[model samples]
Target: MSDTGSYNAVTWLLDRNVDEGRASKLAFTDTVSELTYGDLQKQSRRVANMLRRLGVRREERVAMIMLDTTDFPAVFLGAIRAGIVPVPLNTLLTSDQYAYVLADCRARVLFISEALLPVVKDMVGRLSDLDHVVVCGNDAHGFKKLSDELAGESDSFVTVPTHADEPAFWLYSSGSTGMPKGVRHLHSNLAATAETYASQVLGIREDDVCLSAAKLFFAYGLGNALTFPMSVGATTVLNSERPTPATMFALMNKYNPSIFFGVPTLFSAMLHDEALKHERGGTRLRICTSAGEALPESVGNAWKARFGVDILDGVGSTELLHIFLSNSPDDIKYGTSGRPVPGYKVRLVNEAGAEVSDGEVGELLVDAPSAGEGYWNQRSKSRRTFEGHWTRTGDKYVRDAEGRYTFCGRSDDMFKVSGIWVSPFEVESALITHPAVLEAAVVPEADPEGLLKPKAFVVLRADAKTQGLQEALKEHVQQKIGVWKYPRWIEVVDALPKTATGKIQRFKLRDGAR
Candidate 1:
């Protein structure tokens, strides 16, 4: 595990499990099938052999458009085992976005799931650098079948002696601001997150079972379902279908997982279900974690009251690969993102690059061991985000006297009202606390005098009356936080715009406000 010696992330994640007598342990279970640690290692080796057979060289990129199945881990780790870089794309993106990423990474091979072929089926053979297409299911539609390709290859290959600092994989950002940018992470970065956040905060053990509603395409889910569980040979439950309140509850009741990873949006929806009010049998969730967005204090408290388990709210970004500031089991704060994680440092700075005092909003910058190298094909942006060892998180936060950081809003989402800065998250948090509100988003709109004021977009509960709801919500917000921070205009909608990872796209709302 030394940085100076030969190292491969797959060697530590996949091979180490087999070497330590966990070969027969259940590694992954999907809706259709299951894979053991022994089978995962062997299949990964076969995948390495198949990639080499297809003229894919070391350091070359392979794009993965597969779903949350057992094949995902094998292909991902196999590429790392053969010293090839794998780029896992968000399956929910449009065909144009898929084309942009496939062409951007210049991936030599594309491994896609059968059901998702329609998204990029027309783009096949159109990308300049893409040479081969391999489908992971039965109907290949004239493309190479993954099972057929693996049948001809041997399940024995040597682990490439890659350097610890070598580029292992690429994760494209969710494009909350604009187009997606590829973030490069090293071989050591995977293990760094496991050792710090996974080991210290989650305290994952060998006997634990994990089920993350987040998918593998996301950085949060990649660590939660793949690296974290694999780091200790724990069992992981994978669901390919969309995660709803019913689906997630069914999986939890069936698997009896000890740990669950989810975002704030899903947690809020699950809390609204009447089924959650009744006691479900065989639910053994010991610890639950929330990321991708801040967990509302009311939602967290309500969840703990309904089911005697806390949702550890934390803050992380694609640039950092995983969470660097999180609430642990011992220290439970409902609203604030807990103190800096072990082996990481965080600071808040103003526009002039000076450190901000407590109770003042500033950008949150992190210096972590798992920080990404930089954005691919983006020099100016790379320099702007990755400054020496510090990576700007693009989030505005205020630190309390006790050193807990509370999220304000994104730097771009913050605006001034009455010459005072207004945090959209703070206002949105206040709005969602009302009885009629299900979800809320705040954006700044110019008033008649060309002055900016808060405008809110809200989704109401199923049975709530909307006749006088706006006035009721306005008065409720004024009483909760402050009178000046209430939204000047409120519009109830069916849903809010969000990224594939469940992050609200406030910039889109800003455009509509204009």
Candidate 2:
């Protein structure tokens, strides 16, 4: 199991699939099309050859602004095959947001879907390093159509010989604190992530059909949908749009996938699904995993009761590439973000970098197999995060007596209310425990008295109303945890703000709280 530089994930899959005569075992399927591993390699090589023809060199940035589609995997793996670093951008972001990523990464070329041409066109003059814009369906100004370009190209490519430390791709942070920064992953980083998370933590089976609600632009989604299943020779479903509960449920029925990956927000939505109760379960999903944020125990228990499945959650950051610590099927703990995966170490430390006692909250630091090289261009942030080698995830956590890690909240998310530290998750979880509450987000806001107090925004049950529910929910927290932790004010909202991967955007809530 010695790590080597030549071991890249794509190459490993190509060799295994080809060797085992499972090259055509159908790696990717969507409503529109299906691609086997053989088809994946073919399209990947075609895109790689096309990139080489377009003069994409080693270490160049190839940006993709597209929804989750069949072509995404082709271009993504193709860029890596050609030794270019693929930077997948969220199609849902504004042109200005996309412009920031292009400028920050100095992306040389961008491959965008025609659906997003309007957005990309707005930033054309602003991007200095951008040389080409390859549109997926139709041609634009000085841009080639992906379909036309690949139509005549040969389906063969040479895998680039990359060092273990060589950058393979640059995925961006969620931009909760500021504009998203690019987190760079090396070639072996993908391989290591596939081996560590998929093999050890996920334990994905060859027969398992995997599906992810998170899009490819985000690291967690990309790993679950593309890298993990491909590395393990499993099948995956690629939904070409954002998934609503209904959409996801329909797809589950259509594909009958056994393993599902989603965020806590999505899981909560499914728990409220009336369709689940009426239709019973369509597909017998063996396992479901949650990431992007801590899964409230209330949500987990609700989903399990409704669907006969446990929503095992894990803690991960774009910086660490994927989930480094997660709960497996055998070791399911109801409330904790499980133990560290194989080849990784977890330590909870105080401000001075000293380890905290068990059950005490501290900043979480991870020593993982797939730690990114550093931020793409931010050396200062890089220095701040990388201690010797391990990346500081900036998340706060506690390890209990049983060695299970309980996620407290983000380090930056810990806010002071009346001179005391408060973890929003702790308060939010307490609020959701009320039967009338569907979901809740806690933020610190100043009261009329000028003292900061915890404020809660909640999504009530369909039969519940905001008028009486707010005061009761506030008192419920006081009765459960303490009177000090009770939210001074409560607002019932239809929904909460979330990132692309469905993590609560705490800073947004904090803005309104202020």
Candidate 3:
């Protein structure tokens, strides 16, 4: 845990909010309550005292399964103050998925809210390493009540003196291709992203109120909802409910946040929402960021046309923490991911590990201080993913001479459609441009000739899914982007399967589930 290359980020992230005289400023707000910077610090300290009293030691994993509320950040920051590694779990997971993460992390203690207590109890017996369950809202059965315990504790615990390289937290990857894997992150990682992307690129300030459609468990949301905001003493708007088009619109209208973060899927849903059609302009968002996947240029343009704000398409992974490459407000490339952020380096490498030419598609490798401590417990996967200081992002991209990047697809997402290689993103991007299509996901289906043919599952605009809409979509793709790039099969669906972070799960389509 003593691999120190940077400063203690818990101090760097939160303590400075106090020192900078933002103590009275609102730190976070949700349906339940609001907390100022002083209130957050006070609550976090109490949480730290409770953990220390319960014998939770330095670097021990303390898992939390709660919705996005004020208490979520309290317990999160509290665990870090005590030098415990807090593991925030995806709330939209099944019992088996919860069991795997609880046992895999060897989490000694788990904090669950009253709403999800039943689900946690169902799999509690399977977690051999879990010694205690600190219920957040109500009776704990045989476990302890976290609220009551914190109520008695003094809010004056000292922050632990942990080095920057010490593991501070864990976020499971958004298992798009397979089972989710735990990703270990250092205390310094948050600072790296805040300084480079949040500070240099987004220019978040103390007055900015940040709201993210993506939940906090995922890596992208962690930055948009907490780390990035906390670093600059900015306020964040949180919502306990799931992020639907309605919920996001309500949050934006209610909070009037200056900076808004959302994924492409939700953005498309907002575009198709009848209620939003009557709304005039962007609520209060001056800066809007899109990640979790490569956003289609068509969606970005549509949003810009309606809301009068540009969506900065960026790329990052669990392995690299948050966005290492992105487009800035001043340099919005409509169809391309912008240059690397200030604190990161990027290279496109070919199969033989040689740097590819600018226009050629190659695997993207990124180097940044925000990079994680490799995959948890999987030594072989860790070695392959973390190459020295660089992370093998497993994404293919093409860079132009101007240093702009265009995401091709996941290396595994490309296949031969008819004796020719095709990228699903290329076709899906084109499919979304059609007037009737709201969102599209393309997957390779095995054809009679043994070639992997492209098949599209599309969500059409409301009231646009007529009997002959499928044929229209196919014709549109053929006419706009090359005919060879068109999907051989098209199915109109109400929605596409997505991860907790709003990333389309293409693997499920490949497995014949969608």
Q: For model 1, how does the per-residue alpha-carbon lDDT over 1-514 read when each residue is reduced to its tens digit?
A: 6869889999889889999999999999996989999999999999999999999999999999989999999999999999999999999989989999999999999999999999999987799999999999989999999999999889989999999999999999998677799999999999999999999999999999999999998999999999999999999999898988888888988889999899999999888977664645246788899999999999999889887899999988888999999999999889889989999999999999999999999999999999999999999999999999899999999999999999999999999999888999999999999988999999999999999999999998888888888889999999998888999999888999999888899989999999
TM-score of each: 0.99, 0.95, 0.95
Off by over 4 Å in 1: 275-281
Alpha carbon lDDT at 483, candidate 1: 86
Query: Per-residue lDDT tens digits of candidate 2, residues 144-204?
Result: 8888888888987778876667788888887866788888887777778888888877888
Residue 434 lDDT (model 3)? 83
Which of the predicted structures, 2 or 3, would earn the higher lDDT when compared with the native? 3
lDDT of 3 by residue, 1-514 (tens): 2464435666777878998898899999986789999999899999999888888888899999988889888999899988899999988887778888899999989998878887878778777888888987767776788878888999888788887878899999866566689999988888888889999999998889999988788788889999999988999999888888888887777778898899988887788788777664346778799998888888888889988888988988887889988999999987788999988999999889999998888899998889999889899999999999889999999999999999888888777655766778889999888878778899998777666778999887766747787788889889988888888888878788887777777888888832
How high is the CA lDDT of each candidate model? 0.93, 0.83, 0.86
Clash count per candidate = 0, 0, 0
TM-score, predicted candidate 1 vs. hidden true structure: 0.99
Show pairs that collide, candidate 2: none
- Ranking the candidates on TM-score from highest down gives 1, 3, 2
lDDT of 3: 0.86
